[model samples]
Target chain A: MNESGHNGLVERVAHELKRSIKIDPSFDESVMAEVRRHGKPAMWVRVIAWWRRPQQLSLSPLSMAASAAVLILAVAVSPVRFGNPDGVEPIAEDPAARVIRFELDAPRASSVTLSGDFNDWDLEATPMTRTSSGEWVTTVKLVPGRYEYTFVVDGDKWVPDPAAPPSLFDDFGGTSSTITVPEV
Target chain B: MVESDGQLVRSVLAGDVDRYAILVERYRDRLGRYAYRMLGNLEDSEEVLQDTFVRAFKSLKNCQDPELFGRWVFKILVNRARTAGSIRGRRDRLFVTDEIAILNASDMKQSEYGWREEIERALSELPADQREAFILKYVEELRYDEMAEVTGVGVSALKMRVNRACRRLRELLEGVYRE
Candidate 1:
């Protein structure tokens, strides 16, 4: 009995039979078109324009370090909210920030505040605006160092800041993006 | 042939601006076939091929060898396929053509053979890695070393995969073996 209990020779012969390929007449043209799509655009200006764009999303800071921190918080932890829209957004720039952004999908609690080392554990440095999506954002900028923060979901709940850098030590705590503020 | 891709990449990176056509023309067919076989979906295959070329073009500077453009491009396609494949719950099936090809493969009646469909069904039954090794080595006709480079697997592991594929295929084609 062969491996499958079939005539091993016939199976071997059949295995010898390769899939006959009929390269579609259009195959070359279509793949060429794809090639063209991937190739830089014919227009120098356009190709240059496309080249200027970052290949992968700059996960940390998207350019405007200040705007990034605010947008960073907005884009991150997009699921919750700080109590009200009543404070200036702190601009934290330096060492291109690396952070995981999430949108708050729910409403703010009566005692929503951001707490982190940047604020010396102050839950009142800045208030967050509640967007229609129920997102609250705060830009907490720290020097080139690792810091931990969380959202005071409500007065009693001490939750990690959703927009903050992810912390892998959630076993003892939660997730936070490790921001590498470059030393200029 | 590989030199052309390298030249195009250099030109594209240096802002020479138009040498990419040669690279595209040179690689489109081969990479398309590889991508099609890897993913089975025509649109996705095409997308992966396009993306592979785009990424390969963009990251051309980082490529260690301008000479091994084929291998480099294949790696891009493989990575793209693997990433996309991982996301899908079902494995992508492989067919030689981007869309179904009606033309016949090279005549091989020199050996008594089972129906093409049976071979395909059997070929599909092997695990993904084994099937990959089998197709690349036997169908695509890549050498064991080349398969290792393309797959990023060690040669021994690739051989194991090929052996497993042959064994599984034999089991799948019992009737042929019986005959």
Candidate 2:
């Protein structure tokens, strides 16, 4: 075949190939139903839901009362030393190094691991222990810096911490929670 | 005035979930054609299309450029078609010629020529990458840059794939046309 003949054949093929199939009229409605079924809440809605969730207090009432009483007794026993009698000022202790407790409510998860920038995103670095109340808990001593992290449930399923600040979507198509550890 | 895809995307993101139907209606036929050619079956194509729309709706916010919503959704459709194709491959034999497709082709041509079957056979015989490149280039009439954006492959590589696909397709269908 000549050049134009081959070109004509190709064009014919393209034309035939480009023919639109008659889609089912109800396909759009079916797709919309599926979309509604799997609808993701807006970012602000997720934020509001997180905000409205009931918080679990870490300390028992008896322990809190005892701590308050001890603090009051210590303040009463200590002399009012507004400024040191000596000319020297007391050196402040380093507050950058501290432990932050991370917790998640995953009662059904057999194992939960925490991975983040702190541990180079290693899945096995920090495994969370399940409390009797079915909360997965872990406390990691992190330096004062912003860290991105996610919880791995059952060795897969990376999930962002619900209680943490807003998360950014990672390159791997998952969201990572961000935490800024402030100096005490 | 008709709203652009960007406006619809924004409305959907702003809690007007129903606005997404506009996008689905707009792109379904076009994307459905691409999926039908890619998968060679209407049922699989519809399944992939449904999946693509649902995914696009859920991830509408993650779309970096709402103005390029068509391209973004096309990319998702391509990926879903690939995945669905492979899964379908494992479960069933590849490429069962659809009776409806053949009937439609006969209706269009008003003749008994089975050119559509031959073309679909030729297309199904090509490697997935080459077939995708060819369909995007010729049938979809996408530029190399746009093809690159959709497939995440370099322009030169896509060009080579399209060339190879054309050569292979012509070879496959040469006897059919000669007859």
Candidate 3:
């Protein structure tokens, strides 16, 4: 075909391709159903929910005084823990749970948290510590299983790990990186 | 007066969940067409389209420009279609487009139907990347810059893909047209 004829064919094909298929309103309803199910409370709402959640404390006046006296006596005897001034204690490792280290390089992020199937996708559950070089790192003890996760950068940005394989799209329409722990 | 995409997005984010239906309605058909063309079947396209909207609604707060919601949702649909296509993993499975052509046949003239089927078959034969670039450029009417944003591909590569796609499509369908 000549140049103009070829152009005509291409344009005609493009026009036909652009003719959109008829979509039912039910598609919108199904999407909204999913959105409603995945609807998250705003940060303020979550904060309020946390604040208003019922927490219980039990103490008698006599017991409180006794506890304070004991604390004061212990402090006087040792201004700080003799071997550890910071009073940090080592955590015991579980033989059944495997240690997996998760890291993300987010130098500009004020904070980063790891959320996944392992943590019930809770934003605050697995706060990562910032290293001197600006990488955020955290270790979790997980039993053998496949888990999907993402890094929450600067509190709200959901980012999948660039170094890991991505998981299939979840029911909520998000894709997180997947890690499979082998049975050792 | 019809509300701007920004207004509807803001309302949806502000707890007026019903307003999201409007956004879904506004973009579903356009996005559906892209998905169908990309995936070459109705089932995968509808699934991807639904997921795109749900994902957009779920992540509405992350949308940097609410006024450009359509573009943002189109990006999601593109990503979803890519993933769906990869998972399906074979072109033979895409013969469902033949079923779609038959369903659409009643609405089109006989010659027009045959030409469209030839085009769709030719489109489905191109490499996924070329088909995607061509569809975004011509069918979706997206500019190269916008296509770059959606596909995360550089403009030069996209232009090459579009050029190759047009050439290959013409080569595939020229015989049918001449006859």
Against the native complex, each candidate's DockQ, computed on alpha carbons, is: 0.08, 0.18, 0.21
Worst 10 residues of 3 chain B by lDDT: B90-99
Per-residue lDDT of B15-38 in model 1, one digit per residue for the tens? Answer: 554566577667677666665555
The CAPRI quality class of candidate 2 comes to incorrect
Q: Which segments of model 3 are wrong by more than 4 Å? A: A43-184, B91-94, B98-100
lDDT (0-100) at residue A95 of candidate 2? 56
Q: Sort the candidates on TM-score, descending order.
A: 3, 2, 1
Report model 1's TM-score to 2 decimal places.
0.49
Top candidate on DockQ is 3
Worst 10 residues of 1 chain A by lDDT: A169-178
Using DockQ, rank the candidates from best to worst.
3, 2, 1
True contacts kept of 3: 0.36
Q: Which whole-number lDDT from 0 to 100 does residue A115 have in model 2?
A: 73
Better of 1 and 3 by DockQ: 3
Tell me, per candidate, how large a share of the native contacts it keeps.
0.04, 0.32, 0.36
- lDDT by residue for model 3 (B10-124), tens: 7676666888899988887888899889877788788988877876776676576778988878877776776677666543545345446688788879988888788888888
Indicate whether candidate 1 or candidate 2 has the larger lDDT: 2
DockQ versus reference, model 1: 0.08
